[model samples]
Target: MDINMKKILLLGMGLSSVFLLSACSWIQPLPGAFNVALLEEKDVTGCTKLGTTTSSVLSHVGLYDRDTAAIKKDLILLAKNEAVNMRGDTIVAISPLQDGRMEFAIYDCVK
Candidate 1:
């Protein structure tokens, strides 16, 4: 292949790989941290409304104070052990906070 063509191909592959890595990070648990279903007060629009993954998980977990507390505790534990990894639900809560956007998901230790 021509030098110009080869350079373009390499650049394209490098860019694509970065994008893929970021996407993969979203699904995978953050290294050395437990995933949490963080429900910010702003996320709830109504009794049935859920604005984000964190909010939804909080809602599904119900509006009980003790339950929420325990959930948080478990989440912390996972993070401490590097075992806090989940996809969506199942473990019901597997989220890691990066930036300001909160995420809610399952602690998919299996993955």
Candidate 2:
């Protein structure tokens, strides 16, 4: 390979490595994790239904692999954050969407 071609190849590889490393921490859990109850439909009797919310994780690049477990964990945390924002005590009837997203039915329960 010529000198110019070799330099281009090395730059491409360096950039690829950087992207891969950066993607590793994309789904990290929150510090001092807040507790948001995850409840079933039957368990929502005394709770007041607030509203529905959704969260999603998108792949950074086509070359990157999807981490389902991490995505799920992040989605749960996202829902919990939303619950906190809405001043709700629990999340009920949680469902996974066809895309890399989670749907949450939020509720404010009697504590």
How accurate locally is residue 39 in candidate 2, as Cα lDDT from 0 to 100?
81
User: Which ranges in model 2 have alpha carbons more than 4 Å from their true place?
Assistant: 1-33, 59-61
Candidate 1 residue pairs that clash: 33-79, 34-79, 35-95, 36-95, 85-107, 85-108, 86-106, 86-107, 86-108, 94-105
Instruction: Report the poorest 10 consecutive residues by lDDT, candidate 2.
Output: 24-33
RMSD to the true structure for each prediction, in A, is 15.3, 4.3
**What is candidate 2's TM-score against the reference?**
0.66
| TM-score (all chains, Cα) for each model | 0.30, 0.66
Poorest stretch of ten by lDDT in candidate 1: 55-64
**Model 1 lDDT on a 0 to 1 scale:** 0.38
**Cα-based lDDT at residue 2, candidate 2:** 100
lDDT of 2: 0.73
